[model samples]
Target: MNRTDDISNLFSRFGASADSYLEFGSQFDYKEKPLALVPATPAPEPVVDIAKPVIKHCDTPLAEAATDRVPASSPVHASQSTAPLRHLLAEVARARQAEAQARNEEALRQALPHGRPAKTRAHVIALISAKGGVGKSTLASALATALRLEGGQTLAIDLDPQNALQHHLGAEPDVAGMGNASLNGENWKPLLLAGSAGSLLLPYGAMSEDERRTLERYLDNDRYWLAGQLANMGLGENDVVILDTPPGRTAYLDQALMVADQVLVVATADAACFVTLDQTERLLSERVAMGQAPLCSYVINQFDSARQFCRDMHEVFKRRLGSSLIGVVALDHAIGEALAYGQNPLLEAMSSPACQDMLLLSDTLKTQLKSMDVAESYAS
Candidate 1:
């Protein structure tokens, strides 16, 4: 028999229907279309849930089932997903570096004005006393205000832990000051408060004993710690920094001396105040001999000309200090009234003798600075 007839006979013997053979033979005819080679009754495929990671139980082997499963429509590439995150991180790092660089540049610019070298530091004026209750804080506030009124950028720093300087500067009694900032390792820029006629004030904020001890230790350990912080404030050539230190030989006073360009020893005509001058002078003489101290000056505050003792002390100060006696601030009730009313004497009572004396003191300081500048120029 022919191969085709033999294949047909074999299929019929193997349970293939005659009608199926006839249909297949019709497909081989020249004018007929080919029949599909699919089984009439095929088993249904196992359904897979693509959302889940694991495959359900089935009769098929694990490898064969995995091959049959449909993959995700869009596969994730490891590098593609992480590329944006890496780029974002790099951008943030660059931004932070840029900000730091900007701050450093600004600080340098402020420290060295008119293209002057960094060796020319800002002129620092510190008002110190051996005893308290001599109106040192009051005179400090008024002097700073007067300087500011004369178009000088003035910064008043109250180094007394009592935090009383803010009161004289018209600041709130409870305002946080430099002590809190130093303890928290925060920048001093945000703590600066506005004062009369564009002056800046930094109060000695309230602190616990622990905090106070910590700050004291910090200052004691490093002599230049306070100086370094003040240097970073970006003061210009015309800027004036007035430090009002707590009475007596304290750590704050030492720090002030370390950076002071001029020291104004505030004293009163009272006998107690006069007795303390010898001790204060002895303390300053050592620094003077070492050539480490700034130019020292004296100011007699609360002088009453009507009192004979006051007049005698004033004359003695003039004789002792000569040119160093900057001025005598007459004791005026208006000065105390201004402070009690939360007003700056320089602005509230400009016509008062006390205010006029502060103005004259401001002018004296300006003249001293100008002369120093001229001397430096000549030296250079």
Candidate 2:
């Protein structure tokens, strides 16, 4: 047998019902001669006379004698009354088979348009505060909630060892709470907020003395590393990553700043905080000049226009931060209440006037980040 036959035999052994006729080409009989097919049961004698050579005819001849088997009108055979039903059933079956074949063939060539590119170039945004108790976690949670509900995929990463965003949001640090979550390539549970938008939080996972030390050893370079780790967390297009950092000048903060594509310092509108912003910018600028940092800005938190301190602080911040200052996140009662009640004011308190301000801030931030991404893509 040729290779074609061998392949057919192999397929046949595998119960594939191989069509061997394809190898040699198909055969067809065009003559309209009636061939008497005997029943599956063995006949007592030969039905066709062997002496009569097999005749190939274009038309069938009718039997002449009464003794001869002459077919009656409408072909009154053994299966008589079932004639019309059999013909109808056969036609329906043939049409159905043809339809199925056509559908399968059409499916093979179907493909839709490609997806939209990422709206933001660097997915990570690390939120920092000059000092504690100024609502760093609050703003982080609120921004996360706002961005997610605005049809952006968002993941809030709590980098604070204190875990304030955890308690404020009434969510046990999901990564830690589960105890099973790990960076060691284990199954992790996402802290999904009880809301409509696709927002999530990855609490600093439960770490032992050993894990903490290991994490700390890697902390010096965790800024860019955190971005890589987050991408590995199965995020998608238009996704915004919000990092809630520890309140200090710790190396953790540095890592966050360096990794951040956009850094928003959530500071209160006060002299002390504004001075801290100067120190922060100076630090970032030094590192940026050394080619060790990324782009960033300041988002002055709790700015009340009615208060003189807040109004004056804004001016000082703009002057101190200069063009690096993207926008200010004004003080909002809804934001405080949302944090007090462990909720994201942006999504829930959207109708609140205070929440509207936060929304504006979120929009401005998103716009800035998207523009940065577009510029990067263009440069590339």
Q: Which candidate leads the pack in lDDT?
A: 1
Lowest lDDT 10-mer window, candidate 1? 111-120
Cα error, candidate 1, residue 306 (Å): 1.0
Whole-model Cα lDDT per candidate?
Answer: 0.80, 0.65
Question: 68-148, model 2: which lDDT tens digit per residue?
Answer: 444454355466656677789999999999999677445522421132222333367888776887777777776776764
In angstroms, give how far residue 137 of model 1 lies from its true place. Answer: 0.4
Best by TM-score: 1
Candidate 2 residue 369 Cα shift, in angstroms, is: 2.1
